[model samples]
Structures are given as C-alpha cells and as structure tokens.
Target: MNNEEAARARVVSTADRLFYAQGVQAVGMDAVRSASGVSLKRIYALYPSKDDLVLAVLRHRTEQWNTGLAKAVAAAGTPRDKMLAVFDFLAEWFREDDFRGCAFINFFGELGGGNSKVAAAVREQKTSFQRHVAGLVRDAGGPGHLAPQLALLAEGAQTTAAITRDPGTAAQARAAAETLIRCAFE
Candidate 1:
C-alpha cells in the first residue's frame, strides 16, 4: 500500500485496539497518536474529527465481525449447525483473555446516544445480522419467529458470558438455542 493508506491504517488499528480495550470516550486523540506513531495533524487529516474516527472504527469492526460470523456459518454442515455456530463463535471469543464485550454494544454504551450517524450505522449492522439469521431460519423451514428468538438468546449469551466470565452460560445458552430450534422445526 501507499504511505498515506498505510499511515491511515496504523491510526485505525491503534484506535481499534484502544477503543476495544479502554473504550472510545476514554481514549483521546493524543493516545491514539502516540500508540499509532502518527502525528496529530495526520490523524485529524485522515479522520476529520474523533467522532468520525470512532465511526470509522465501528464500521470496520462491524464488517470484520460479520465476515467472521459468515465464515463460521458457511463452514458448518447443516442449517442447524450453522445456526448453532453463533454460539460456538461466541463461546470461543469469550474464552479469549482480552475479550471485553461486543464492540458495537460497548460503543453504544460508551456514547449513550446523540451521534445520529453512529447510531444509524449500528442499527443497520444489527438489523443486517438479524435478517441474515432470519433468512437461515426461513430456509430451514423453522417457525417464522425462530430467528429473532435465537438472535435474542445469542445476544444474551454474549452479554452474560462477558459479565459473568462464565463459559457455562454460553453452553447453557447454546443448549437453550438448540431446544428452541428443535421445537421450531417440530
């Protein structure tokens, strides 16, 4: 890549790690500059403002997550397996020592509304995910409501596992999801 692209990437990467670890509000421009080894002028030039930078980071992370989830689902053999893959994915993620929580959820928590662009982007990403899973359920001939139910369970599992640091909660959540899927199919 060119120097400009590389420099911008460094800034985003640094911001991504810091924002994920400390939070968006807690991490300032100077911290990002120091961590990225990029000048404040360059950072501002690339992003225009901190809010813009935060939105970029959120969009990048959201795309990364959706790509990972799509891969996990595609790798599974059956529709049921694909559906269950969400839990498996979360379970493995939660096992990581640095896994704080879902970045989008955490971003919203930190910002607490007011940024219309970020809020809209987050809502669009979430709705896309829900529709993706819902499409899978529809294809599997499960009940119409099955997708949202499983999505709620999956979301709850992520929150609970993050909060409690209990892997068992994920397993229980997976089991609950399985039961729901089976019931829907029956």
Candidate 2:
C-alpha cells in the first residue's frame, strides 16, 4: 500500500479495536494515534476528525460483518439451514475472545442521540441486515414479512450473549427461529 493508504488503514484498524472494546465515546484520537503508531498529524489528515474516523470504522465494520454473515449462510446445505446459519455465525462471533456484541448497536447506544452521521450508519447496517434476513426467510419458504421477527430474535441473541458472555444464547435464538419459521408456513 502507499504510505497514506497504509497510515489510513492503520488508523482505522486501531480505532476499530479500541472503539469496539471500550467505546467510541471512550476512545480518543490520541489513543488511536498511540495504538496505531500513526502520527497525529497524519491521522487528522486522513480522517479529518474523530467523527470522520468513527464513520470510517463503522462503514468498514459493516462491510466485514455482512461479508462474514453471507459466507456463513452460504456454507449451509439448505435454505432452512441457511436461515439457521445466521445463529451459527452469531455463536462463533460471541465465542470470540474479544466479542463485544453488535458494534453498530453499541455505537448507536453511545452516540445515536447526538450524532446524525453515526446514527445514519447504524440505521443503514440494521436495515441491510433485516433485508438480508427477509430474503433468506422468503427463500426458506417462510413469509418474508416474518423477517422482522427473525431479525428481532437474532438481535436479541446477540444482546443477551454480549451481556451474559454466554455463547449458548445463539442456540436458543436458533430454536426460537425454527419455531417462528415453522409457524409462519403453517
């Protein structure tokens, strides 16, 4: 990578870990500079401001999160299995040593009330997720309309797992989704 590109990537990567681990509001630019080993002058030149850096991090995370989910779902054998694979993805994610739940959810909780840009990014991530779930439901012979309910269960699983630090919540959510999908077809 070019020098500027390398610096920007370092800043964003460092910020992603710090912001997700602590919180966006809790992490500061100096901390990002220190953690990334990027000079403060370059950090500012790349991101322009903390908000800019935050927006970049959120956007980067959204892409990565969506890609991971899609890959997991695709690896399943059947439509129904694909639908259930979302919880499998969650299970693995929650088991990660540094699992911090949904970054968008955390970011929204931290700054959604005051920051329009952050709020927008959060909403976009959620909307995209729900849309993906809805498509999976439709493909799996469940009503697409039931996507919201399924999304609720998936999100609940993530929240509960994050709070309780228990990966088992994913199984519970998957079981609940199975019931919801079965009932939707009946």
Candidate 3:
C-alpha cells in the first residue's frame, strides 16, 4: 500500500482497538496517536475529527464483523446448521481476547442518542443482521417472522456473555434457537 493508505490503515486499526477496549468517549485522539504511532498531523489529515474517526472505525468494524458472521453461516452444512451457526459465531467472538461484545451495540450505547450518524449506522447494521437471520430462516423452511425472535436470542446471548464473561451463553442461545425452530417448523 502507499504511505497514505498504510498510515490510514494503521490509524483506523489502532483507533478500533482503543475505542473498543475503552469507550469512544474515554479514548481521545492523542491516545490514538500514541497507540497508533501515527503523527497527529496524519491522523487529523486522515480522519479530520474524533467523530470522523469513530465513524470510520465503526464502519470498518461493521464490515469485518458481518463478513465473519456470513462466512460462519455459509460454512454450516444445512439451513438449520446455518441458523445455529450464528450462535457459534458469537461464541467464538466472545472468546476473542479483545472481544467487547457487539461493536454496534456498544457504539449505540455510547453515542447513539447524541449522534444521529452513529445511531443510523448502528441501526443499519442491526437491520442488516436481522435480515440475514431471516434469510437463513426462510432457507430452513421456517417463517420469516421468526428471524427477529432469533436475532433477539443472539443479541441477548452476546449481551449476557459480555456482562457475565461467559462464552457458554452461545450454547444457551443455540438451545433456545433449537427450541424455537422445532416449535416453529416441526
């Protein structure tokens, strides 16, 4: 990559790690500069402002996170397996050393009310995820409406796992999904 591209990548990566580890409000641009080792001039030239940086970081994370989920779902053997794979994805994410729950959820909690752009981004991510689950449900011969319920289970599992520091919540969510699937389609 060119110098500018490389610098921008480093800044975004560093910002993502710092913001996720510490809340967006808690981590300042200076901290990002120090952590990223990118000069302050380059940071501002690239991001312009902390809000801009935060938005960029959120967008970057949204893509990476969703891409990972899509891969996990695609790898499953069947539609039902695909549906359950959502929880499997969550369990793996929760087990990550730096996992801080869903980045969209955490971002919303931090700045959604105050920032319309951030709120919209978070909403888009959630809507997209729900639709993904709904598609899997449809493929599995289940009612599409059950997608929201399944999404809720996955969200709850993530939140619970985050708060309780328990990756096993994914299993609980998978069990719940199994029950829901059985009752809905079987």
TM-score of each: 0.95, 0.97, 0.97
Write one digit per residue (lDDT tens) for candidate 1, span 41-115. Answer: 999999999998998888788878888888888888988898998888778788889888778788877784878
- Kindly list the per-residue Cα lDDT of model 2 for residues 98-166, writing each as its tens digit: 998999999999999999999999999999999999899888778767899989999999889999999
Ranking by lDDT: 2, 3, 1
Supply the global lDDT for candidate 1: 0.86
**Root-mean-square deviation (CA) per prediction:** 1.2, 1.0, 1.0
lDDT accuracy of residue 52 in candidate 3: 91
RMSD of 1: 1.2
Backbone clashes for every candidate come to 0, 0, 0
User: In lDDT terms, how accurate is model 3?
Assistant: 0.90
Question: Which residue segments of model 1 deviate by more than 4 Å?
Answer: none
Error of 2 at 157 (Å): 1.0
lDDT for every model?
A: 0.86, 0.92, 0.90
Q: Candidate 2 regions off by >4 Å? A: none
